[model samples]
Target: MTSPGSIRRIRRIDLRRSALTGGPVDYRRAVPRAEFDVEAAVDIVKPITDAVRERGVEAILEFNARFDGVEQTEIRVPVEVLHRALEKLAPEIRAALEESIARLRATCQAELETDAVTELGPGARVTHRKVPVGRVGLYVPGGLAPLVSSVVMNVVPAQVAGVESIALASPPQKEFGGLPHPSILAACALLGVEEVYAVGGAQAIAMFAYGVEASATTEGCERVDLVTGPGNIYVVTAKRVLKGQVGIDSEAGPTEIAILADDTADAAYVAADLISQAEHDPLAAAVLVTSSERLADEVEAELDKQVSVTKHAERIGISLSGSQSGIVLVDDVEQGIDVVNAYAAEHLEIHTQNPDVAASRIRNAGAIFVGPHAPVSLGDYCAGSNHVLPTGGCACHSSGLSVRAFTKSVHVVDYSREGLAAVRDHVVTLAEAEDLPGHGAAVSVRFSEPSPVESGETTP
Candidate 1:
């Protein structure tokens, strides 16, 4: 085994030998904690948010200069510039983006829902209508990678949900002359998003939550009703603090992938999939919970060979060797499944001989990939499954970004005179039982030509 500090070292947990209390070891306790503390980050971003609230766009520009190091004269990118970015995009990349957009659009359209009308009686009905949010702000991180696919991921669902007004904001790139990366802009153009902004981090989220007051340099954005998309700690913290002000997708943590494999699984395929996720960030977790010691050793060796030649080798190395990433040796395939379920990874891959059976048993995961061919990278780009999934065990309770995330369900109740009469006594009875005489009175008063007890009194 290599030393912990070595890039080649990945923590190995032999659960069979450990003194874990329960039948299944709590995998989460063994995993490395993220450097980002959202609560602590709240303290750091509170002042920035307060400043933005006080000064508006002037504060955004100040934060942009202080944090992003790019001084943008104008926040919103011109529509013409968005179009030009598409025209100049490389043909191969553009073709790929177009295919991704088409695939995602088709999937989103299929997921589109219709209003349901439930008729309780002849004259009364409750219609559950799916309403698209009026306006939204989408964030795209312009960090390590360009993440052009994110533009498609965030924009397509909102479009499918019929969101009329959409605004996208990414960190201003110094290389792009104080604008978001051309690829990011090109994606906006491809999706027909006219409103784009050159901003990023906490400031951008702040800008979206409380729209900047219109000024000489910019027309300013309308405060969005909802905000979706992923970013770093500061971005997540911004979303957390501004939750009530605007709707947010989820408080996403570091990216994670958990592979539940057996002796029959391919070692090379497992290693490649693990490496793909590790490239995202140093905190990105690539966990393998497996029954076969032989397969684990093979994967460890394969990772060494593959990571050495990858483009982002340094980043990938740090991620794999970090406490967050490792291999957990379980007693058997069933135990592996138990371990993964407890971990509730963002992405779970089943590479067993009975992949379908294994995948079907999974209770917690943002998305499940079956067999060897369905890699996490495929889902990230063209799987048609939204890539903005919950991370850091959030898959246990939360869902990924989707058309449903962009829509709000509203119940429309309609009651005729007879229908009101039918439920009036029941309403009055329940309201009175709850000790609210006024509520019962409100219902009884409507049909108060004269109650049986009040027949002697003059009707008002």
Candidate 2:
């Protein structure tokens, strides 16, 4: 409430008055598809990544101190700081952290696949075993809110994948004395991560990629084999620049959601879910595809009415009205499916009759929700699916975080003398046909003595 003596501006908004809201229940013809342009974000990502490569860690730190407003000599969060976070965190926070540990661990255990072996023939064994990267770096955003869930999303998968060492980084908070938010540390502690960094933004990505300077000796460094998690555009750009040096999950982008609804869908529920994701960021996208013109009209009205009540109303408005987001009124469910596939949204929520059947048809999406009960927010917290997903239409080819992101497969080859003899000629023929005599020589060394002629065998 403003002070009585102070001048105050009172604003009023009624969604029913807006034209964007599908009104008068138009069913005569299919509404035009809402035009979505990807060029805008693509234009931003390239430069951001280029700048990170040219400027290196200094560039990253400048952006962090500039945007995040915390200055520090060292980028890595120290041991003492994380311990303090645990010491000072609230009890209820501890309870939630413990519960999250159990739930997320269960998800990881249930989802991860173990190593396998197959016998190609007698005396020959081919094995596929999951090998964790030697070192992994997990990024967590600490700007608007400390994404405690991200810490779990990243760490749990790495642990399940058997990553030897996991390092997590987040922006230092001026409000919290340049320490990562306590909940972030608590989540880390729950997973037994003693290595946490207070740096943030592209710099955090760089610190993990390039390693931080030693405050003590000023000569030592820490490096990682893979970097994972979601961050701002700058962070995404940094990942792009360092991709060749280290593995990255995906080129992260702004958050997004696409809700497919029918007449049976609750307009209020649809609007609420759309706004819920929109509140994430201005660049975030929220699209609603529906077969029912009536439900579309109602949802449009609901967006306005609902956005007014949310805490981040401006963010919701910007996300919902952004060029990438809008309501697509289709001819029917089939047409709606086509639109959604083209969009390839980060999150796809189906609020149609036989939602399971409709959801099963979706071939591209970072994550999915069925019916009114399963919202994207559930996935953000405790839905068992990793919330860190491919965004900005990246769902077209990418996927959400999972145990597989932390694990790599290394083929194990074992062959007995008989096994080698059985395929020796085949291997030698193919190797020679490839036009490199040295390729065949490696195997020929074993029988270079001409194999005693093998009782009428001839060397080709």
Candidate 3:
């Protein structure tokens, strides 16, 4: 618990103007964000990836000893170890994880895409196919928290997408005798994932990108087609370095939550939600955008009351007071919507007169939580929505992890002789217009000669 005198203050940004004296407001600049520089970390992580590429599992073992301070002899966890972890898991926690898995599995099944065919002409048709990646590497962080829920979030989607192979990696915990946290292992067992590794940091990304060979004491890990999940700076930097070698979900940064509340919103709920995200990391962002000044004042007071007794008071206090966390005072709900869209938080909550209306207008945000009952914490675990999301205004262009991320879209074309004839002149004319006669020749050569079979002639 934090003492009253030591409590940090959350700053305010006033966006309400007396008169219309502006062109389009640059709401992006008005919002606060943490200084997350993945480029700066390239030099530190590149060496680790390069070593893993060159030395294989040997490099991973060396790094595990150096960085994680766990003298690990093997990289992969045995099958019996996974089963033992599950056997030892508490009944209540196991029940909760099972429920979360069921809900997420249902949602992923609903979101799975299917093939679609289109006929452009009498004999020409195209089929759009949804194909799953051959294999995927799911990285779960072991820092601060065990993140057992991450196992469910990453595995269920890849399974739903029908990925043939799935591998998971987490940092080796010294306290857990050089294996991943028992809870994470248990979740993996419950999800029926057999390939698990006790590796972490950028090396895990490199191991997935460049497959390691079998060593004296360890069975090597096979390369994966794609990698997904969240991590810290080193993990994000490694993804950037090895992006072309393998597919990556997103360069996830610190967690963040923004609440767009009005006078109708409850102050206690808003404050508690803000504190919940803050508990994730000291750098996590918690922003409040509202039209009611009185509500703002009440929420601030409620935060003080709540933070004084929370278990993670120091961490929550640091996050709430950081420059990345603050309150934005907008003139009204419309202006509030504009502000939140430009900010593009990872998680956005709408607590207004009509949460549905406010949520509909939101153009950005990795995920939107509507009404008082739908808190960001619910989405983090049991809301059936993915907890892995885009951060640092990335929602403006990217999206959260889902079954779609693990699948690829391919177009298959089928055409007959008559179909080619139907568009021969058009293809030739367009190819000639582009000054590439070879393109036209490829289509022209197919029809230049008639086959005996097509002419219905018999050879003696």
- Backbone clashes for every candidate come to 0, 1, 0
lDDT per residue, candidate 3, 277-327, as tens digits?
999998999999999999999999999899988988888998999889999
lDDT tens per residue, model 2, 364-447: 889989989999998888777788898766787887888888888999999876778788888889998999888788887877
Which ten-residue region of model 1 has the weakest summed lDDT? 1-10
Which candidate number maximizes lDDT?
3
Clashes of 3: 0
Each model's C-alpha lDDT? 0.89, 0.74, 0.94
Residue 365 of model 1 has an lDDT of 93
Against the hidden true structure, what lDDT does model 3 obtain?
0.94
lDDT of each residue in 1-460, candidate 1, tens digit only? 2322355678888876454666744666765445568998999898888888889888888888888788877899999999999999999999999999999999999999999999988689999999999999999999888889999999999999999999999999888888999999999998999999998999889999988887788768889999999899999999999998889999888899999999999999999999999999988999998888999999998988888888888888899888888888888878777778778888999999899998999998999999999999999999988999998788889999999999999999998666888999899899989999899898787686856544565547
Deviation from native of the Cα of residue 108 in model 1, angstroms: 0.8
Report clash pairs, candidate 2: 77-197
By the TM-score metric, which is better: model 2 or model 3? 3
**CA RMSD of each candidate after superposition:** 3.4, 6.8, 2.0
